[model samples]
Target: MNPAMNESSHTPPLVEISGLCKWFGEFSALYDINLQVNSGERVVVCGPSGSGKSTMIRCINQLEEHQAGTIKVDGREVMPGMKQIEEVRRDVGMVFQSFNLFPHLTVVENLTIGPIRNKLVSKTEATERAMHYLERVHIAEQADKYPPQLSGGQQQRVAIARSLCLQPKIMLFDEPTSALDPEMIAGVLDVMIELAEGGMTMICVTHEMGFARRVADRIVFMDFGEIVEVAEPETFFNSPRTERAKLFLSQLLGH
Candidate 1:
């Protein structure tokens, strides 16, 4: 077993994407993307700009429609216009590059919206749950403040707390730290590391190699919409097989 995924187990896949293809008009954004994330595994997807790392994760939750192939969440195939998509999405939590919190709502209110609307949680109950996650993220004091009133790191913490309120089975992060300033990145990654240590099944699209090596069970590299390589972090960073992957890692680690 690779040291990166010391506790990695061969359980059934929680999220499976096979032969997945996506396009924007005439341009293909993903080409035959395939991946499977097992329960309690944390996979980090890395690539250069325009490499479709974000698009691939988006397809897992149907945020971006795919043109071909299958995405199964917890054994149910995800199909557009299918009623099960809502049910599947309810169990999947996503955090985007931007902290998409409602600026007008207080931090706690932002966290409560999804559970109250979809989970049928009582306002009082939702607030309590929100506070729990906020505390977990080390930002309970910011709960009553509005998104705009907090720093970038604080707002992103609120976003994470909001997702946790939904109690998702799988968490997807699309460049969650990319938008933050250098100093603020550590705070978000710290929370993500905590989540990983707690055995959360997670897939993150990020360039943060330190986080990938320290917390990821596997590192998946993509280029030109193709999954170039997938391996445990030690092998991937130290001895990538594919030239594309080696070049990509050299560029990243050499900096």
Candidate 2:
């Protein structure tokens, strides 16, 4: 094995991105981005709308293709190639803001399909795993409920549980709480905090500064398709290095 592989064998980063760039037509959505996330590290990315924060996480799971640069998950490259992308996605799960559950299927059914189809687990085994994660997200009680029947918070928790059933090495969350009521946000954040505490590698795009402060090992700030700043939550929040970051924080924190 390569020395890099050997070193990673001991302490592998779950995901790495280098010189990442993405564009649509002539417009750049992300620019020359670089980042690494070690196994079990929790990172929160925040930026103003249209800053490419959502696009960045979407690329990690191959939901969006980067016109340039490279992304790796668990030492495997993620690219437009089908085999590589599928392999990477198998170990990397994503939860979206809209909670894309199957309205026709019950919660348990939604959670079981992916693992059974992709992981090739038997239905019995998949259901058991689904129940385990459903319990973890505190919604096993709603396992039989349809998506429309649950509150937004409950639905998001089900989405989390569905992703977990895949046994992904990393989880990517795109504005997971953005669509919820203020009162409902805490329930989803609590599950996310528990996931972080239990050592799951996670990359989340959210404006929830309190959640970032409490859970993130690092916070990345982006603007106009560029990563302007990356730091520990305390440093990023208290003494931002870039003027754009300061101005952004001013807007977020309200002076």
Candidate 3:
């Protein structure tokens, strides 16, 4: 997986980060980050807690502004106040650890609101679009119910459907299954795997080693505010290049 920064010969990568850095007052959250994700690539990022994995993906979608470095989506730089920022955001869907669904809104309403309000889609069209994705995530039967009426796994699937309603070109998952009960984790991961198989350009920050191994084209390992390793799943799992990666795998895999 040629992740070089310069791929001007063909269509540019879907997402690119060069020398990215982030700081929060006295603490540095990320340092000198560089990575490129091409179209239809599934990149899984894993690391210990407080290791900047979430911060890095959050930076990609502009949920967290970086202090330094360039992040380009479809070759357009992501900045705090860029005129095209909204356009960029519309094309990039983010699913968080928390469901973040509005309790007052029905599942379908939660999904339709974004497209209707932001994209000027008609309510009927939005609802139809919402249901289409709801079915995709295997939660269409829960469409008329409120988020609080569903289980954790169902709620998270609704969140996934909401993101899909926008028909985003890229999807970012931030520890999506972390908040779920152990049994619910597989349902969310199943939906994610299906999404990956459908050729979504995905950047997932997850600790689910099985999902990472099954879906990721490359595994990005981060620690102490820096990316320490990048390798395919087999190589990373069996023979990590760095001591930090080795220790992280051992701890996570219980070896």
Candidate 4:
């Protein structure tokens, strides 16, 4: 085993990407991307709106197919085949900007579906897991409510719990708090911070510099479909290596 792997045996980065590139029609969405997250590393990706941060992560779970290069999760390559893609997605859970809960299902039901479908756990066992995660996210009381009945932050927390119910090795968040109100943002961030403290591998795309500063082991900055800088959060924030990164940070922190 690698020395790094020996030190952290619990959740060492179950995923890695190298030379990853993605294109839409003629426009490139990602270029020569390289990133490695140790089993439980908390990585925050920040960049301007069109910087491709979302696209890079979307490729990891095969949600957005990459045109070239390799993506490996839990040491398994993510390929074009449906079985491969489904397996990768089963181990990696994603939370979106807009909470993607099922309107027809109750909160508890939404959480139970994935595990039941993928793991074939009995409904009773799945509900047990769903409720566990719901309590973890502080929404156990709302388990019977429908998605439309909850607040945005509550809905997002449910979404997080739903993913956790799958027992994914890594969690991906794409602008999770973007649609939340200021007061509610803290509640969601609190749960995320707790998850990080417990050593959950995470890759999050958000403009919340405060959350990045507190939780990120490293910060990745991308621009024009390419990574411009990857550094410790302090270094990335205090002295960005690239001019593009500097400009982007300036606009974000200036406000």
Candidate 5:
């Protein structure tokens, strides 16, 4: 019945990280990292190579474990060796730079396997879900083709559809366009932009400033294993608050 207590009872963020730290032998990949992503928020992470941008998001899905930190997804605590880790993973979908599709499987099969095997959905239902997502990505016509048969962009679209099959609450993209040819990048970005417009919560690690400006609600700049600045896209690109960010933007946009 206290006024201050009532005021502080706001909803928690959809994904929350606190005091996150990671080490590879003696090298600290991430240090004292903290971040929170809310429902339907699109966050873009940008930084130079080896700045721990990828490592930080990987920790969110537990692809790589952190030695110390607290990660909570949907208000459930996520820690190393937790039995509920699989549940956490199911809610967090990730697309890597590489397509990572099954070489021998058809596109439809690749999309359905996770739901059929993991969620125990019937084959009919899984295929229906697969086709729906494939259609959403504009690759339904290629659903019967193998990964080897599709162009790089089509293959990446399949990869995105595969993740969507799970109907995850959050999507993590680890440089989704970096592995594609320059001509192939636009297709993938188009699919991503469409997903953003549909209000999917997304955390992307990319150097594509154009995409960031167009899609991101906030831009997170990291350097030397630490977050250098966090700001709105307009502020981050036009008038960054930190010296590191200013220099980074200058070098990145210098051409």
Candidate 6:
């Protein structure tokens, strides 16, 4: 077994963060945050609105720069202005809460843009990969339609398909279902659960405990800009160690 495996016997984390902190002028958004996501792991981070969950995930891909600490992806330390950042970005795909689809483009076009722009594939190949993921997300039939023509759930699914066309090794979902209607949330989550079962490494910042319970290997609890607890889903929900986590679970799970 690799010595770096942290109990599950998997290899070292595909993503690792240590002593990460982010600041905006006088305000601090993150502090002393540390986390790791082993390959094929699904980690769900849940917490209050200001808990820095989104910022932490954003830093993993350099979407948000951290003032202090180190983030390494695939064993290479993330550095600013380095060509390695592009490689890291290519290996990691992110799906935001808002669909972020191009309104002027058809779903197929939207999905092909990243691969085509990066010259990762020829136009024909990108389109083929786009359709494959669209089918996987159950929306291949809508490939010719523009973003506005799709339902909220369908748009979010398209967003997921767009990310998949990149053939990334890891996926980051920042509150992917937050902008959807209650009815739409489940559809998006269902696709995510399928993605998880397929053994894709995923780090999600979402408040949906049910989804966490269903698909997450571990749940990370953050509060006031710091990680408060990290536990397996069953232990996290049933036996949280911190009052902040308990209160958060109660508030979220409370009717």
| lDDT (Cα, tens digit) per residue for candidate 6, span 150-189 | 9999999999999899988899999999999999998899
lDDT of 3 by residue, 1-255 (tens): 333324535878889999999998989999999999888889999999999999999898788999899999988899876777778888899999998999999999999998988965999999999989999999899989999999999999999989888888799999999999999999999999999988788999999999999999999999999999999999999999999999998988786
Q: Over 4 Å off in model 5, which ranges?
A: 1-9
| lDDT assessment of candidate 4 | 0.90
RMSD in Å for all candidates: 3.0, 3.1, 3.0, 2.5, 4.1, 2.6
Clashes of each: 0, 0, 0, 5, 0, 0
lDDT of each: 0.89, 0.91, 0.91, 0.90, 0.91, 0.90
TM-scores, each model vs. reference: 0.94, 0.94, 0.95, 0.95, 0.95, 0.94
Score residue 254 of candidate 3 by CA lDDT.
86
> Tens-digit lDDT track for model 1 on 1-255?
323245445445788899999999999999998899887789999989899999999888898889899999887898767776877888899998889999988999999999998866898999899899999999998887889899898888888888889999899999999999999999999999999998888999999999999999899999999999999999998889999998887888786
Give candidate 3's whole-model lDDT: 0.91
Which lDDT tens digits does candidate 5 get at residues 210-252? 9999999999999999988999999999999999999999999
What is the Cα-based TM-score of model 4?
0.95
On lDDT, the stronger of 3 and 4 is 3
Clashing pairs in 2: none
Give candidate 4 regions above 4 Å deviation: 1-5, 8-13
Q: Which stretches of candidate 3 lie over 4 Å from their true place?
A: 1-9
Better of 3 and 6 by lDDT: 3
**Predicted candidate 2 versus true structure: per-residue lDDT over 131-207, tens digit per residue:** 99999999889989899999999999999999898888889999999999999999999999999888788999999
CA shift of 37, model 5, Å: 0.4
Ten-residue region with minimum lDDT total, candidate 5: 1-10
Candidate 5, residue 22: the lDDT equals 95
Q: What does candidate 1 score on TM?
A: 0.94
